[model samples]
Target chain A: MTALGHVPGPVGAAPPAPEASRRGLSGYLLMLPGTLWLAFFFIVPTVTLVASSLYDPSGTFAEGYQMTWHWQNYTDAWSEYASTFLRSFLYAGATTVACVLLGFPLAYAIAFKAGRWRSLMLVAVIAPFFTSFLVRTLSWKLLLSDNGFIVGLAQALPFVGEDFRLLATPAAVITGLTYNFLPFMVLPLYASLEKVDPRLIEAAGDLYASPFTALRKVTIPLAMPGLVAGTLLTFIPAAGDFINAELLGNPRTRMIGNDINDLFKSSVIPTAAALSVTLMAAIIVMVLFYVRKAGTEELV
Target chain B: MTAVASRGVRGWLGNHAVLIFGLLVLLYMFTPIFVVVLMSFNDPVGRLGYDFAGFTLYNWKNICEPYQLCESVGNSIKIALLATGLATVLGSLMAYAMVRHYFRGRGTANLMIFLPMASPEIVLGSSLLALFVNANLAGQLGFWTVFVSHVMFCLSFIVITVKARLSGLDPRLEQAAADLYANEWQTFGRVTLPLMMPGIVSAALLSFSLSFDDFIITNLNSGQMITFPMFVWGSAQKGIPMQINVVGTIMFLLALGMVLGGLLLRRIRERPTA
Candidate 1:
């Protein structure tokens, strides 16, 4: 075939500059499969969920529920699960703050301080995640149990009492959330931090700024995009997470996700759907507000 | 002079403080993993209790001794592989289109791709379940439903990963290929596709892991299907089987091996090429 003949060419031939092809039909054609997949599976399902949330509260699936445009379902759901919603946000906020505190240093060390070991440290950061998440959370259960070494260590600490238990408390839930989502925070921080010029920090040092001042003024501003991204990533999922609460916390620490999950299980589909939609809307609003306040427009 | 020396020492300690704190954080992250690995070896005296007793290899030796654990693992692998393949293919094409072409609705397309990642897992899972229930397909929720959800979630991640790699690529190489009188197909097959391999590979790996590790979404839509995560959840309520740790350890080692192996292979390839 003549087509095959064109494969081998003169190796050193200086080819002409590549001409920009017209914005043709192939691009749209190429996008068709994936876009259709997302549209059907993601977009359609989301619409269906919203519709289901408006179904009559009194009607079961077997009884053929009608969509009466019930906005009251949201109100009912909210009144029933408002505390759970507030608790989810609280836990998520705490987790996000904790992740920032823990992940920033680790990400900074990997980006700037690890030097030749940077790649290895990066790998190490993600290596633990290869284990199943449930398993990891379960191990946390073991580690935080009353007689575990972690509890013993905490008991030995100056502020902590001998009677303080870490497991099945809000502290345990928040700890699990922080641990599980820390990588999400770290990876983005690393990405943004790696791009910052070392000279800026050096210049700050040369200008007689202390290390803390240099970090705050020079490094933190440059890493804002990553920080915003990291916080959003950490907060959103942490808010929705029932796994940590279910495994690590007592009923007192249950979050909105637990309520949604429980409601769905109990065949309260309309209420569950309403709660899910509310959770998503609340998160989106918070995210939009935070991103605007943080002044990072590139994330979307 | 003493004050000056002490100040200098204090500053140096402050400089290295972040690194020390970082290492401590790393240690904290690995603490539970160590417990899991250690627990895997523990021959617990009772029915899969959390307490560590004398170490033995019995769990490793009889990983499938627990009822349906191996079956669920097999199901997870099957679903993960299927979802990864489907998502990677679909997502890479979408990423390619987004980056390489000046398409209309690009902004909307980007938003669509991003929405799933931004949305909570609970919403996504419940929505899919709701869709199935409304369509009267609720009774049929099983492997196929789980498979579909896995693909949906994994698609967003794949698209993002590959798009990052695609956007960063220098187009000059493809231009050079075209300048050599190569057709679009030849140029793509020879230059563009080869260059995008790393992105595609990483995306596939990400997709596989996401699908494999997903619990919340799978739990909602899976009906009676017991993927590994669902199995773990079910078992956690009853006594957890010690064999789960063996599986966990194996997954960690295998993933670590694959990543390191990929790095090694890339290094080997780049050495001569460079």
Candidate 2:
């Protein structure tokens, strides 16, 4: 991801160069505190989680659990929560597609068509997110309530029954997920799209290609890095998010996150740990496969 | 004449199509925010469902009327500030090492920094809870545990942000300071730190927001403690207080004010030079 690289400075200017000489002892020393923090708080926790997954189911956290190498925990958690896992991916995947459809146009517009309003548009994209997350989702609950204006409108549509409602539906959950993560999709897409040379599109237009053809042939390929980055950013968090599902979905629509949260809350530590590890592994494998399939090895 | 007029209209629409579409998307994003703002002023006729009743300023004036709402908000602010301070310091150093110094296992360090951001929040929270419980620190899951988790997550973001800023910086400026007979400490304090201030400040702001808005991670680790999100989640199950919307509105306004103030300050500073 470009998060690791230097974001190029103002257009047409060279980015700053890194120091060419190798740094010695001081470099590792400088990294010591942060690396230790990550090791203890981040890496160690992940290791502990994997270990906890193998703990015997009979033990509790209060009484102390034992590491029994309980492989069945994985199998049991997987088989029972398979639907939840599938639903998480499905919702996340749909949210990613929706974000791209909605965000690509917005990013493209800001990059090319916004003119003097570019910064204003960018601020607008981020401003809504600065408010409380739970508060915003709660507002959605209000907006989609059975007697709310949106549902009333939906009821008026053809083939929609009078009993229809938006709240506690998969549609509401997906909408919440999409709304919350749209900025993630937009920012990277804007970063890449803004860097695209305008002349290439103009050249395509001059060569008898229509605007659509120019966009498809010239622009889409150039924005591949951003598309991949935005999709992953949107999808990964969307999959892991339980707040929307909990706030907006009914019991039947529970994702893996909800299951994990409930299990952890109810003191089902081993199962929760196993499920958490499985979800993480699944995401990592999917990401690696995606990066491979997209042939964008520059992503790290 | 009619055909030419139609063609002209088509051309105009073509030119502005994406722009129009984008505005719509932005509108969609802000609709819920509008609801939140509107609901803050709402006078609920009923105890529960979130219909916008008559407008009133009662909720705004009595923001802390709800039980533990203000307390939870105070806790969140305290935790966010502490987490931001710690994460920014550690992260800035790590970013400096990654960008300015070529070291062994540099690639591994970079991977470590990126992995937390890549992992989902549920996994992060559960894994951290697992760690705490395994270490026999389950009983100690409160502000400190939440603080630890916040810093862990915020570090990756801060490092990524500061690394980008540092990588975009020209090393020659510091070299020039050295050539002018300045000591290393003097150069760092006067030249490098001043130049890096914007990045550090923005990274701090980002970390604060992330820490403040976090729910799932905090909820899992925060045993018997209530942050603002936890408060909201609890209230959601019961009847929600209009005061929650008041808090949300105030937060939005505060953040907006900070952003605008920063922009204004930058413009004022640039004016004399320009």
Candidate 3:
């Protein structure tokens, strides 16, 4: 996690001295190429996406779309694909919660209990990232297959029936999402928890607090920044992800990403653009609300 | 005496409980990779490589059995290399500027760098596609378009990684170098650059993996070009070939070897100095 270790540090830290006085045009010169690359590719393209979303729905790619200021595109897209949007959010929300439940303990152990094996454990957490993404997702598809061990084991449970299956269900898709993004959640949580002094926990214990109470009152509050960051990182991408649904889920479980990709493929640009913009806007609003509630504005 | 012994046992269990749970979670994380490695040697009877019927080394022997798999892999390697090089250089410069020098609009610049990272891949891909279409380059979308988009996304990650490495440096080293009558270029080249090399290398590695594994953005922009992920995606809709798992296994092994090798080298190097 060394590469990703310092990401959540204070973003607006002051510039170092010794070069502050000599910085005339050299700073701008150094910043020019990269900043211009981002400006042209990232900033301009976002504006294009927004503009394209409002194009008239009747126009074709061959005939060129007209800027009809069609505010109706939003309503039309929402009316048609609202369920997909909701499903995306639902899946993403579920994935985030599952990640927190699973990731917190793993992160906690690595932070405080792993001792000298901490670096090795951290490497293990991120080792999955080296493999190709699609290949790993395909492995999940195999693991959750109807005749696979997982499903067979589930059937052996008294509560589950003999015909029980895990594949092509919301559970499977959520499982895939949780598994794929677990590292994202763990890393940030570990980053923040690693900074917690043992003395603080001991202090809480000496003050007549139980171990659990110390964790609740002291450790968790200190880990809020990481929690906020981890959740956002997990939720935003999971909400926009379609790979799990496409592979591990049935047609009924398609997320907003599936539709966006389909619409784009079918040459329905404005609608796809509308959906993309809507997803971005929805994520932004939720993230803003979340960060505000969590009181970590500097994370952004 | 019995009561005290039982309490000691209970305390030991309590202390190890979280560690055991953490190891289980790590096991869960590696389950898919285990499946992948197992399936790499699988000899499937049907077109779909779902169930492992028998053991065979056929997939490893002929990894290029699937048409266009190797080609797509070559393209991915080429793109990843080029994208990593460009992003690393450009991003290191930007990081150097942001950390070492005072500049106006620093906050705005930081925001600009952060936005691309925070945005979803779908949004970034679609936005890039939208820009291409607006520029009348829709029909011309190919390797270059995908390359540009890869660089665009990889740039922010490189900057962040390098910036983290840059800002953590002990500035007094450079001050010490200057006191030895070293000029700016000499001090930077000899001292600063050497220290920053680890960060830059890690940043390059991060960008390479990001660019290589990128499917969402590349899929949107690549009109007719098929990268490795795109190849797997296409085959996934049909029946995936067993050779794909071989590729997966190789990637995992290569990356693991490199990282562990680096760690070993670092340990060995630090011993003598320490």
Tens digit per residue, CA lDDT, model 3, A1-300: 132222233544544543443478999999999999999999999999999999998988778899998989999999999999999999999999999999999999998888768779988998999899999999999999998999999899999999899999999999999999999999989988987766677789899999899999999999988998899989999999999999999999999999998888788999999999999999888877876765432463
CAPRI quality band, candidate 2:
medium
| lDDT for model 3 | 0.90
Kindly list the per-residue Cα lDDT of model 1 for residues B79-103, writing each as its tens digit: 9999999999999998888778767
Compared with the true structure, all predictions reach lDDT values of 0.88, 0.89, 0.90
User: After superposition, which runs of candidate 1 have C-alpha atoms over 4 Å from their true positions?
Assistant: A1-22, A290-297, B1-12, B272-274
Question: Against the true two-chain complex, what DockQ does each candidate achieve?
Answer: 0.54, 0.74, 0.64
Q: Per-residue lDDT tens digits of candidate 2, residues B1-274?
A: 9999999999889778989999999999999989989999999987454788798998888888888999999999999999999999999988888877778987678778888988999999999999999888899999999999999999999988887777778888888999999998898899988888889998999899999999999999999999999999999999899999989999999988888788779878989997
What are the runs in model 3 whose C-alpha is more than 4 Å off? A1-22, A290-300, B1-6
Which docking band does candidate 1 fall into?
medium
Q: Output the lDDT of residue A147, model 1.
A: 93
> Whose lDDT is higher: candidate 1's or candidate 2's?
2
Candidate 2 per-residue C-alpha lDDT over A1-300 given as tens digits, one digit per residue, 9 for 90 to 100: 121122335665765567735467878898999999999989999999999999999998679898899999999999999999999999999999999999999999888888757777988898986899999999999888888899999899999998898899999999999999999999989988988877777879899999799989999989888888899899999999999999999998899999999999988999999999999999999787767755432343
